[model samples]
Each structure stands twice: as structure tokens, then as C-alpha cells.
Target: MGNLCAGASPATDETIASADPVERALAIAKRDLAKGAGKWQELYSYDRSKLLGSGAYAQVVKATRKGTQKSYATKIIKKGQYDKSVVIKEIAISNILSEHPNCTKLIEVYEDKANYYLVMELVSGGMMFDRIVKKGHYSEKEAAEAMAVLLSFVSFMHAKGIIDRDLKPDNILLSDDTDSAIIKIIDFGTGEFMKEGQTLSAGIGTAQYMAPEVFKGKYDQRADIWSLGVIMYILLVGFMPFGGKNDAAIEKAVLRGKYALEGEEWDEVSDEAKDMVRSMLQSDPDKRATLQQLQAHPWFAAAASASESAAKGTRMVSRLRGFLASTRLKRLAMLVVASNFKAEEVDQLRELFVTADTNKNNLVDFNELRTALSKLGRAVDETELRRLFDAADMDGSGELDYREFVAALVGQDVVERCTTARHGAFKDMDADGDGYLTPEEVLKMMPPGSTLEEAQEMVKAADKDGDGRLDLNELEILLKN
Candidate 1:
């Protein structure tokens, strides 16, 4: 509050001292975000003339952080555009969902006197439908992969009582321009959380993908499933499920719950796939597939089980060992390195992670890791397996998160190739810039509920020089050795 940036204007003392509840909430939220984001990087500069896009409430501009090349989409929203609750809600929901590998990560948030800044991950990959249309062909495997991510996203959101309200190919995007790029579900501005047995008025969504129940003005999360089914249908074929020359006609067909799988496109598509689509597009929400049924559907299961070979599994185990041998700080460095890679760069490892998670819980436990590594000639010792799992579980969550799994599977060459990455890792831990990492500094990286004692023990293990702190050399050795 002393001055977030130079030449910046803050709310007047009168406004700051307002009795308004919303003003107080906004102030609290901004303070918390600033704390979590840590030290500021000075004022963000953007060219007002060159804008990305502008909506009623905000104008988006492409922003690159001062010291780094990483680009973020920063939305400068008018403070009065919406209530403080809306902005806070968006920030809260986005932060929660960003943990999923497929969601657009929220980078940082800031607010000034007259405007609020929301910085988010920049996804350059074209929209899902456009990518497919340009590629000229979409395979069964591609369709299945897209659906799998979308299905998992829906499952994840529904379990948390959230509804996207808008679920369409246009809202989904690839991480990058690659055949193996993972899907990034986006645009949760219209999202809402439902109370049990509640019927939603249903927020804004495209007509073609909107469920019939949505048109009827009361629907629930099953509407998301319907939208996803429309996407699968479009991928399997080359056209919309309820095609029309205009949106009105499209909505009419959606209400009728009529779509054809009787064209030349359907001949090549499996009957199993068609059946699944029909189940999802039911006019009656009750008759439509529930999340559980959709997940267990034969077509979906058949599509999900379609990865190649056990040799990949054995190879992944070897990588996991190298990852486990590294200290948590080093492991985090490697993860940061991996995250910067292109979609194709880590696609194979991504696949391996998905395959290793047998229950599809989006995390890998020791047994799951065991199954993935079992293709090796020698049976992995239980003790050795436990050790590996413990090492990869960065947050001590008893499981390997997707990023942790990716860090383990990324080649050592990739991890060490970026000197910048190594230095970045060291700098993050050396909070005092003393060229050494202390237990107190390391504790910053540990999960909530982790103790200074645990951090001290971590330091003891990595303090190779025995001076009770980690130097740059020790960190590098731990990263690669």
C-alpha cells in the first residue's frame, strides 16, 4: 500500500476508509494476492494503443514480465465495471482450477486506484475447432484424447460443485501447435457453483452446444456433459451435431435432441462412439449420461486404453530413479525447466504420466508407479519403490502431482540444458542472496503444515559442504546426480 509501483495512484484516504463492505473485501483480496505473489517486479508497462481485446469490463494487453521472456495476458479491468464480488470470485475459482494441468494458470493479480490487473497464462495455441479445421483431418485417437481431457475437466469441476456454463471447442485450446499438445480448458468468467438439488438458470453458452434443458431455463452440470458430447461428435465427423445455417435453427435442433450419425463420416467412426454421443445428447437431462456413467461408458474406456507399448513404461521407471535421487529443491528446478518446454517437448512424458495413473485420479501413488515400471525384467523392491515415491512427492502429499511426475520423466539433458533454469532454482532458495540456502529459506518452498524441523532435515541431507547450508554447486549436483 506504500506505493505498489512508481507514478501509480492509489485510492484516496476517504475511499480507503469507506464503510462499504465491497471496498473492504476488495482491499483484503488485493492484499492477500500481493502477499502470495511475494516481492513485486515494479510497474507493468503496456502500450495502450496496441490491445489484445476489450470486453465491457476489461481491456486485455500482452505483457511480458520485466526480467523474463515469459508472456502473460494481463486484463486491466475498470474497478467499477462489476462488483468486487465478481472479481474476487473469478480470482478464487481460477486459482483453485489452475492446479489441473489443463487449466490456464493465473500468474498474478494487482490493483491500482482506478483499475485492477489480472495476469494469466498466455495460450498461443489456436482454438480447438480451428486447429482441427486447419489440420484437415481429426483421427479417432485425437477425438478420444480431446474428450478424455474434457471429460476429466468436467469431472474435476463437478466434484467441486462448479459448472463451466460454457463448454465448447471454442473455449478449449491446445497448449501449443503440436499434434500431442494437451488441452487447456479456459474462460471461466461465467462459471458458477451449484447447491445440491439446485436448478440453474444456466449462464451464457453457445447455442449449438447448449443442452435442451438449458433452453428450458433450468439445468445442472449435465449440461456440460452435453456440450462435451457435441465436441466429440464434431471431432468424429466434420460438422456440428445439430447443424444449421443459423443459431436459431441450431437451438431448435438442440431442443429436439436430434443429430445424425448416418453420414459417410459415421461409417469410419465406431458404433461405440456414436452410442456414447447419443447418450450424452439426450433431450431429457435425467436420461442424459451422468458423470459416472459417461466415465464408465464402453466407448470412452475403449478409447482411453489406446496407448502403445510396455517398453515406454520401463523407460519411464529409469527416468523416475534419476528424478528421485535429486533433492526437492533440485526437483522443483527441473520442473520449472520442464514447464517452459513446448507441448511436443513433454507430450510423451505427459502420456506416460496419464498411463501410470491407472485409476485416473490425476496423481501417481507407489502402486501406480509400480504398474508403470513393472515392464522391466527385474521386480522393483517394495522398499526401493517407497523411496522413489517419497522423493517424487514434492509436497509430501503421498502422491506425485502431474508436475512432479513430469519433472521425474524429463530427460536429465533437458533439466541441465538450461543454465538459466539451474540458476533460477538456486536463486529461489537463496532468499537472502547470501549465495547459500538456509533451512528457513527452504521452508518457504515446503507445503503448509510442514515444519522448520523438516526443512532443517532437508538442509542436512543436501548440505554436502557440511556448513549447514546449500551452495550453488551442491544444488546443481543434486539436480543431476
Candidate 2:
């Protein structure tokens, strides 16, 4: 009755300030269910699952929709840890900038007496720094491609008066663990909104990537250009451009802006690439390359042209189709890449769901799911296999139900809505939003002249499972028909 799908928990009557975090999350969920207003309706539709990460002031946890396998990351911050005004500004900035393809999306916001919950898109791909470490090296072309993508996002955000004070590689994420995965800039915790001429005074960014003007405690949007330059240098060559043994040394080196491009790594690298980095790393904020100039630079243009030409000549589409057809991981990646699809762009996804649900039990288990993939043709290591399996198994029951399967492929809110008890529309008379229609509520909803016996008979007729009370599902059956 609470949410007829299996493993669904009933909403709690307790206040949102409960001692247990899990209980608090549930209380908020129930609160939203009773109201069912705006984005919170779908956000509260999910059950708070595993803890993703924790910081000094907040913790991020995974939330999965009850009937579907859709996944999202919810950042739960205690109200006392941050200033209320700053939190509001951060949320506003996130909402405004999230629409860009390269920026991480913030889906919904919810709050309790003690905490604020921010639900955002979950990107499983590792950080750019970690990826660079794993790969060990990159070509200038690769570096240019990554910079172009990052700069485009920065340009978009700056145009909207949002400055990402932190632009380190740790904040840049790949969409997936693939050679051709798209880049996503994340973690706007230190982001601030400023006008074109406004300058920030706080020293809030990572030391190694901080611009010289930032150390002076006053700098404009050009400060971000310095960080981008450092990122490009690190990506192209395998080390930081600034030579330092510690933070103090790094700050000194950054202030000097005298890093060299003389090394075996730079032997084959073009001078244009180094020149682009120099333009960004200039000590004077006024002299730093603007986002427009950076994007229009020859290196960026070359990368864009090469990318276009390769796309036109490549059979990567057929290969991508095979990759998606071969594994659940690849299919999920496809869904994430195509996460912004319109309603009409996803008709074929339902068919993909049917294909993955091979057992025809309206559920998909790990073995059956792996069997759907071309095991021999596409090799999946143990780590990735477990990640794919566990993510789809929302209930931890070793199987993905129909809704879960669809949510895993697309997104949590992308699936069609599940039926709720329509008869519970008289929630005012019920006095509680526990998905039950009491005899009193039935009387109120019934005709004005209806008798108690008639109301009892009505409840009896609607009670399908015979629990003595009419649940949402039973009420829905009687009312919807």
C-alpha cells in the first residue's frame, strides 16, 4: 500500500530531526509523498542507499528510486555547518549552470530541520587526475581536446557570472572509463557568482593551481584561466609546471610564473601548445587569455578540426553500437551520454529493456544480464562487472525488476510514473498520508446521504487483498476504473 513495489518502506510519522540519518531521510521522503509538490516528489521517490563520500561538513550518499533502479547522489549537509545565505547562492548557481553538457547536473533540492539535501547526477567515471595517473601520458592532441571541452564549459559559466574558484584536475571528471569518454567539470562547492568587473578576495582554491593574482587576495574571471593553463600543462606533460617541494614553494613558483617547457616530454610538443599555456599562466590577470581568446587559439581550433574530421571518417558509430549491445556497462554509459534525450528520443530504450530482461520474469539477475553481453567479444573485468551488477540490484536482491532495469539504463526520473492510490485524494479526511482510506474518509468521499453500512460496503468492495482497510493500490483500483 505504501508503494506496492517490493522492498518499499512506509513513510514515517516522526519529525525530520530524527537521530538516525536513515530515519531522517525516510521522514523527509514521507513528508514529500504527502505533499507531492514540484521536484521533491520524484526526489523523495527514491530510497537513500549507500554512502558515496563524506567531507568535513557534509556527506554524499546514493539514492535509488523505490520501484526503479535509477541512481542519484544526494549531498546531505548539516544546516549548522554552512552559512544559510551561501548555501542559497550555491544552489542558485548550480541550478543555473547545470544545463551545460560539460557541467555536472543538480537535479533537485530538499531540506529538513537539521540538514539540506542536494541531489545531483551520479558520474561513475574516475577523476581526470586519477585518469592521467593511470594512463601515465597523453599526446598534445589529447590535451588540446580536453582543454577545449573544459574551456567551453568555463566560458559558458563565466558568461553567466559564475566563477569556479576551484578548477583543479581533481574537480574534472570523465563521463566513463573509456578512451573516448567526455569530460565533466564538477564540485562547485567553492564557486561564486560575480559580475564582469567584480573581483574575489578569498583564497579558496587548490594551492598548485592558484593564479598569482589570487594570492594577492583580489582577482577576476581571469584567475580561472590560470588554473586551466596549469591543467593543460599537466595533461600534456606528466607533471606540474610549477617546481615546488611544498605549498610554500609552489606558491612562490606560481607567483614567479617562470616555469619551463624544456624537457624530453616537450621535445615533440608544438610551440603553439606551450604558447597557449603561457598566455593562460601570465602573472598579470589583465594579460591572461580570456575564455574567448583561449577557445579561438590555434591549438584549440586544430583539436576541434581534427575531432570533426575523425568523426566524419570513422565507423565509431557502428563500434559504439556494438559496445552498447555487448555489455550492461556500455549500455548504461550510452544512457548517461544520451541522458539529455527528449521524450521522443527514447522510444527504443524500452525495447532495450526487453532485450536485457532475458528471463522474462520481469526481472534481470546478474548471470542473465552478463549472458546478454557478448562475453567473449567484450571482456569485462571483475571490478566493472561488480559495479554494473550492484548498481542495477537496487534492492540488493540479486535481480533488477522492470522499473529498476529501465532506471539503470536511462535515469531515475526518466521512467514512466507508477500508479498511486487515486482514492486517497480525500487525504484531508484521512488525517494521515499513509496511503490508507479510513472508513471516515470513505464516508466523506461518498455521497452526502450515504450510510455507514454503505461506506463499509464500499471499503469492503475495494479491499482487494482483504486487509480490512483500503490501501492506496486497492483504492486506486476502485477509483481509477
Candidate 3:
């Protein structure tokens, strides 16, 4: 038997080696670490400090990459204790929504003999509940705007066929410590993709946010809309729509849709907002407001217009840059933060990022950035400038890439120059005329300190097929994304 196994063909031997779970996992992790340039290396490169938190089956730790200085929340799960299928599914779902501004993106996944490590975006800011607590009381208009953003995100997910079975204030996180930071929906462990006419039968979700249909073991994506209603209610009035001394009681209240707006907090809230909540909290899933209907409602329309007006009024590049400098957010996280700013605000900052490109190399060095900021009247001291520039120069490139610059100053969602210069840039990275960019070629093209694994992950994300290489079509799709 041993001789037979050993004599297996190359492909068969590869398959047999991977049949042992530990060996399979170790191979994946080591292969990733060896690359030293991809997100996979993010796990090995980062120095883990204190434990961030623990869940029912996993624990998260705070980590900072050695060379890049980027921080990430690494969620470590014991491999033997959980369902591998569920973990894989959750990772896939997280990756699908990773680039969404309002989701806690899954940066990378790794495994060892005993544990599965999920490296994800670390939101330094606490939960939405914590924010509301810190403020003592929140304005109705602010709550309305937050809901608008949340609803927009959920709408985006539904359009992509994803359903966030879990939605609550605790799962909703503010992107940063700032009051105006974007709100992100986190913890997509219960999220699933559904096809047209499909209904989920799983009884999953927190009791308070659980739609009544969930108790009956039949539900659809609309269940998420109902949870949003509960969240909207709590956002306006600092309390849950359904509450009791025990889980059973809370579940009962949720099932019955037992909630009232009788409180000092609700005294000042508009009836229109309350009516909107009522529509969303409908006991019947069919009667509930879809994301489209919710957005088209007068409440969101008014609140959205108000938010746009507020954003327009504060569209000063100086103020925006000052905010960026103050936050001290990671360069990657800065991109998400930037996405929240108005286009005019981003356009003005683009001039700065461009002006900082003194050598016209499309990359900005520390001194060039400092000079540009000084010319713009936002001068920073040598120490602060060095710190800020270092943080933004991911990959230890010594200079900021265009995406990094936009992330630091412009905004997260701003298109990279690569979109317009696609072919030239793609060809430049291709190096050889091999029709495909190999790992070695990709590593050379990326910034310093970037891992070969990171480049591989980029290719994998855009590869579409299971092929290990990218073609021009794939490159365009990746650039657009």
C-alpha cells in the first residue's frame, strides 16, 4: 500500500498529499508566506499583539505588518471545532463584498495544523451602539443619514444576490473615531447568496432582529429589511424595538412585532420617520418595504438631500486633508473614508495628489507630498509628515502609488489612473510577451515589500476561470472593479 501511494502519478500524489487536512492547510499557509508580497503574507508578516476579542468559535487579535505597517484584525478559528464548509462559504461571501464601502472586507485567509486564520479590515472605531452611547443622544437627522447609507449598502448586496441574515447595531461599525465616519455592516457569517424565487429555510439570526417568518423556518432576503427596521427604530430612539428579561421573551416580542414609540426620546421624532419604520417592521414579509421602496420613501429622500447639502457645504480640500491627517487611519482604510467625501472634495484633493507627483513618475515621494501640502497651506511638521507618509506608503515603496495617494487624500472609491491607462500599464507589468503575467513578473511590478502571494491573489480575484494567470480581458475587469 505504501509503495502504491508513493508510486502515484504527480497529479495523484499532489491530491493524496492534500487529503491529509493538516498537510493541506500547512501547504497553503507556507506557500502564501513564501510569496512575501500578497495578502496571504499579511498573516505571517504582521506581529500579533493582544487579543482583540473572541466569538463563539473564533478569537480575533490585533496585528501590524512588519514592513507595510498596516494593521489588521486576524480572526483565528480552531479547525477541529467548526464546520469547514461553513467557514469556506463565509470566506467566499466576505470576499464578494470586500470592496463595498460599508462591509468589513476579508483581506486574506490562512490555515495551520490547528486553526483557520481570517485576516480582515480592522475597524478601530467601536460599534454603532458605542457611538450612540458616547454622544449621549443622537440627532434624528444624523440617524436618518446613517440609515440611508446602510440601506444603500444592503441594496447593493441584494443586487449582487447576497443576503445579510444578520443585521444589528452591534454588527454595524463606524469606520473611524470621527463623528462623520462612514457606517459599515460587519459579521457576514450568516450571509448567503440566493437565486431568483429561492427562499431560505434556515432559522438563523439574533432574536431581536429575527423576522417573524424566520421563527417559522422559512424566510428570504426580505428578512434583512425587517432587521433594518428594528435598527432604524433603535437609532432614532436609544432602545431596541423588542426587549425582555430573557431570550424567550425577546423572541416572543420579535415574533409578535411588539413595539411602541412611547418614550421621551420619541417625543421629538417626526411621525413620518415612525411611519416608515412601521412599514418596514411589517409582520408579513410580503408587506415589508423592499430596499427600493425604502429608498424611494420621502424620509430617505429628505435625509439624503440633507446629507448631500451638508457635504456640499463643507467641500473644502483643506478641511478634507486636515481630517485625513487627524484620523491617522491606515492607507487602505483611508480609501473607505475618502469614499464618503463629495466628488468636488475629492477632485480638489486629486490636484494635490497629482502635484505631489513631482517627478511625474505617477508616484509621490515623502518630500514631494510635504511640498504639495505646504503649498496648499496645510503644512505639517517634519515628524508628523514622516509618520503620515510612512503609514500611507504601503508595500514600503518609499513613494505613494496613485491608489495609495487617492486613499490617503482623495477618497476610497476614486478610480485609479489605471482605468484610463489600462493596456499600457498591464503590458508594462507583463514584462515578457508570455501573454500572461506570472508570479515573478507580478512581484517585480508591485511595490516593494508586496508579496508574490498578494499578486497571486489579485490574479485569482480577476482570473474568472480557475486558470492561474490573467489575460487582457481579466485585466480590464480587475481594473474596473
Q: Who wins the lDDT comparison?
A: 1
| TM-score between model 3 and native | 0.55
List runs of model 2 lying over 4 Å from the truth: 1-51, 243-245, 303-481
Ranking by TM-score: 3, 1, 2
**Runs off by more than 4 Å, candidate 1:** 1-42, 47-56, 78-80, 304-481
Error of 1 at 426 (Å): 55
What would the TM-score be for candidate 2 when compared with the true structure? Answer: 0.54
lDDT of 3 by residue, 39-79 (tens): 44433554355777777888778777667778888777765
Question: What is the lDDT for 260 in model 1?
Answer: 86
TM per candidate comes to 0.55, 0.54, 0.55
Report how far off residue 24 is in candidate 2 (Å).
30
lDDT agreement with native, every candidate: 0.72, 0.64, 0.67
Q: Per-residue alpha-carbon lDDT of model 2 for 44-106, expressed as tens digits?
A: 544354566677878877776555668877777766546544544566667667789988797
Candidate 2 collision pairs: 69-404
Model 1, 1-481: lDDT tens per residue? 1232432223345544668633543454445554544233364556678786687778878887777766787877676546555565566567767878899887878765577678888877768877756533355567777787788888888876678888887778787888788789776777776766888884468888888888888888888888888888888765787878888888788877767888534655667888988888888888888878877778867655544453354345455666776666667556555556666667777887887788989998878888777743324668877877777777788888887887777766555556666777677667799999888987887779889998888888878879988888887777755
Give the C-alpha lDDT of model 1.
Answer: 0.72
Candidate 2 deviates by what RMSD?
23.0
